[model samples]
Target: MTHLTLSDYDISAERGFLCRYDAPDVELHGKMAAVRNVAMALPKTLVTGRLRDLMLRDLPNNVEADDIADLTDEQARMAMVHYSFLIQAYVWGEADAPALLPRALAVPMHALAERLGQQPLLPYSGYVLDNWGLFDADRPIDLDNIFMIQPFLGGQDEAWFVLVHVAIEARAGKVLAAIPTILNAIATGDTDTVRVELEGMATHWAAINALFDRMPERCDPHTYFTRVRPYIHGWKDNPALPGGLIYEGVEAFGGKPQAFRGQTGSQSSIVPTMDALMQVGHADDPLKAYLDQLHIYRPPGHRKFIDDVRTQSSLRHFVEGAGDRDLTLAYNAIIQAVADFRSRHLQYAASYIQKQGKTSAGNDPDVGTGGTPFMKYLKKHRDETKARLIDA
Candidate 1:
């Protein structure tokens, strides 16, 4: 458990699962410099219906896999964040969704994706984890000081949507950092320590919920659905792409279509890590299956951290048998916290996506960005979490 600290996974105890490095170097060299410029212009070009045109005109071809691989891990992540937005915008930014992704985007993105062990599209890491920067270097990563580094249509709505998630990730750091201690306490039958840790986790969960409550402050639901949501949808199960996207000049696909899930909050490791800590389980279903598939979309170290937590945690079993009223109460608080968070998420899914009017080919109001009918499953999972509470 000692070896499972957040830093090992490129996650910061202070930043939770947010990027651990400084803002990416602004002055990229040669062809990549152009790529960076194109990526930066997306917020404007996408609205002007000229993103694809700009990419086609300026994006370089055959950015060697070796060159993409040569960048340090943080730089690679920054590149992936930019390339992912470019690829998504290229496909969905225009009116008619393009079936073929030019080698300019597909080739280097594939190589970067391979190097990072992530899907070659926008992922949770790119969306929230690595795609942020501080307004003030001396300040902590909070709603006031944090801003999105990369965005599809950057504005208050989009910025608020991302910053809220960033705030929650940073807020969860205390709880995440206490995992080893909680596990150790549970293993040692130190009910007092376990109780305190669980209570602390519950407190952090409350703060996280408060952060979640701010989603609607500046991010209008309709704007999120029509503008922000469209570019993030994946090719799989999406009618726009039908058979998926063809990645040109990438040897792995052999000129065939590749289907990868788009960026979704489900890919965020926060809830999954919490579930693992609480030993909560969702029955096998499409959403569950989809989630398991998304495990590969997370950074490799994060996947390991979640796996290790699930394997190492026996807190529920320990709490059930302890027969300590206070301990059971503390544990149940966390369960309720998880359910509460899910309940809010379910509400937002309906308002921010499900209930919104459909405006384009790829952005289906009924389907999540990750390509699932999420309403039913989200409710079901929330109910199941409530069922996990140990009754007195």
Candidate 2:
């Protein structure tokens, strides 16, 4: 019964699930400017105690949930981005992470995270979705025109890694736009319309995979494992922080440790959305459980979109029964695309994280940033998707 319109979920044909926020606006001035100033310099200030020093001196104080509640949606999102980056740097920037987050950082970050309905740390929405801007407003959000607005180390590798994800999110708009059309076409038994839309969806997916293929162009595997991967890790399931992280002054936490998943590509709603549309179900397993846990990490609207697509779509069932060669072929093409993307992602997981040597306690090479034995499940999901293809 849920409407499938993009705007209903704050999504769009131009940006897909990516946040519509652009950086460097007049709104980020005044009180919030201090947060951005500190975040912009986080990479350069990552000496043993330098980040902590900069944060205590430079970060604004007395930020409460009420203050976040007063701002417009854009300002709130910007605040989340700045505060999330600063919190991650404070926790992971040094050689050893501190068990306790100071009251100054903990209080504001907790309030912002509460207001945004996410955990009090970096999230995919803040990390990649909202953490980007255009080099030139007139150009598209392609790799050439886009750059990461916030980064842990601000290197070519880091920027390239994040920017590639952004580019894929932009390209996904077309595929998302086709969802309702395909579903409605299925309902009307309009096989031709369904076939055309499925073909288009598969084409857009190919472009997304092309973007994924460029991951190593600038983000070296070793650099990604050491520099880029370490800071984004959350405390849960991490051997380094067995007790999890403590937010010293976030009264809601009662001085106990908090555990949340790190920002990983799995949190992106694109694959989930596609899975929902195709009705590709994963057997309940550790990876499925981890993915279910990550559902809350996404923006609430995205969660709704995925759920609606799953419940409402009859594409797979229709294709299986249509007995139309072209329609079944179109549906099979999309299934194959999803399978291929997962396979490439599995390869990257092995090369980018699994094969790389361990450099820090927090970043376990065997575990994914989201805290799963990813290699085993990535293969499972890929095979499951491929098996869903309609048989001739």
Candidate 3:
């Protein structure tokens, strides 16, 4: 019944989204447009908190370009971690709940997914290739999270569907400025309307990335990030972790079996150290956190797929620097996982082909003579993906 907007959250003012863009002339205007559009969409009461006044409206029109750049990239990166889980939360959990995005959505991998998906997979974490496969499809449930549903009665469909929006939003902050527009269409569940937004998201990513790249990060990444090193791995310069966002408060949801298991214990961070053999690890790896993020991304198949991610993460980390013997063993184990999945699918598809065989109205047109439907799907998808997603 109600619409979704980002102003409902406390972190609205602190969000570092626009800073990542180098819009000297447009920076302040861009910031205002982003905030006002969302703020105006919701009741003024929602956006009028003290800091919101201070943070949203009071910042100087000539806000320092440098501070914007630095703060924004950090927050933009942080946005993905929170945004990823919010999708899942909106899809599966209570709509009127507190900021689950802040608490449950703090995993590094999801942030990394945002980073890669936004930045184009070059500096990407190794886990992405094995775990994620996204086609640019938007669902009727996009923005179905706590922030939106608290006022509406969005059950699973609404909650799970929000993830489609989160994935798009994290990388394209400008689109987030247009949340009301998107949700209005999503609420209608009109295929044509949803398609318009989805196409915009694809282009918004292109334009935003282009904006960020226009200004050379005057502050070097090495220098910029070094300031964060003391905070990131618990070195204790500021007595806080990244985002001052404490993560220990998160809990494991049993329904999503793999959710946070590998992430939970550097030891349990998936199938446990004994099972996964700790192939990959860091003091603050965010594997568990990522699961919390994934929790809302796919509510219907939440447990199985998250378990898949957890299993995938642990196995990936297990033999990073392993010896020849260990490498061979680990590689074989991965090979088996791939083979088993492929074999199962192959069998299922084969059966479908067999059914088609019995129903053939005409004579068998040479079983292996021409290409099969599966082959066409695989080949077409592969070529299209390469052409569209891969940069020359």
Candidate 4:
């Protein structure tokens, strides 16, 4: 077998994922540039404060759909990138409470995506898609490849912190792409096809594990714990935004004032996909519930997309069939690997949260945060299925 490298990974189709604002010609001299200028002008302590008020109050009530109708394709693309950051910093970053995004930003963003042939601007979509090539398996992953829209203080190690997420996402795309084939096989009752696809899915997950193994080489654990970890912190214990950057005049969850957490990295993105593949239910399952809550921090449409994928009921059927031991093992291993992946993240969080002199009060510090319930679910499914297979 040939050794796989980042260079061997095809990125030609992924270019569409890059943000136009990062292009050389755009520089720091556009409408979005003005937005950044305004943000930079704010006092560090009040950055979230001013942006919230501006987005809530100043946005015009009657802005038309055609507001971005005349923007050149390039201009519209830049607008998507610009509004993405603006929304993230102001509306989403206000960890105090949930804030309703004003029509001023929302309407125009919809129009911009329509023009650009892109999906609605989701937080982290731009970050992940634009910076994915940094983990090109062949080259050494480095900070030079990371794209930062806002000021971050953690230096190169911090850059590695973000890049690893991009790598995970890259691997996730492979698993996600295979979902349809796997589901289709189950729907048709094609046992052989189901086994083949399950093996393929397992291969993608193995690649994700490989990336995790590479973490030590990319950035030493000490550097990640001290320098890179700080950037992942939220506003809960932060002194700068003591009240958690209030969301003015917004009443959410029984009229409580809203304060959101600071920037968290992108581990939540994988939750829904994992839930769908593992046949985990969101209603009563603790792990699924935790992941479902995290989706609130994501863009509006993200969870919906995950839900759509979950509607396919084939994976659970195949596992429940319990006809093949090897296939059953592969399925079990995939679920176990995902659980292990979540455990790895928790380990990192435990160290980072501890070093920051903060508590994981509301957030569980334990592995999987949701009690590793999925592993138990998978184990039960595997053992029962294996028993039936042997009895036959």
- Candidate of highest lDDT: 1
Model 1 lDDT per residue over 1-392, tens place:
45466677777768788777766443466777778888998877888877777678878775889889778777788888889989888998888988899988999999998999888989998988888888788998889998888888888988899889989998988889888788888878999999998898998999999999999999999988877888889988888888999999999999999998988999989899989999999999899999898999998989999999999999899998999999999999999999999999999998998888889988888898988788999999999999999987
Task: Kindly list the per-residue Cα lDDT of model 3 for residues 1-392, writing each as its tens digit.
Answer: 35434353211212212122211222223433343233223223232333223322432233222323443433433333223322322222221212222222333323334333431011111111111222322421113221221111223322222222222233444444433444454345433443354345445545433333322223232321222111111101111111222322223222221211111001111112112222322222233343233333221221332243334333222223223343434334433332332343343333323333322111121121111123334233223222321111
| TM-score against truth, every candidate | 0.97, 0.97, 0.24, 0.60
lDDT of each: 0.87, 0.87, 0.27, 0.48
C-alpha lDDT of residue 29 in model 1: 68
**Candidate with better TM-score, 1 vs 4:** 1
Tens digits of per-residue lDDT for model 2, 216-236: 899999999988998898888
lDDT of 2: 0.87
- Of 1 and 3, the candidate ahead on lDDT is 1
**Number of clashing pairs, model 2?**
0
lDDT of candidate 1?
A: 0.87
Model 4 alpha-carbon miss at residue 336, Å:
2.4
Q: What's the candidate order when arranged by decreasing lDDT?
A: 1, 2, 4, 3
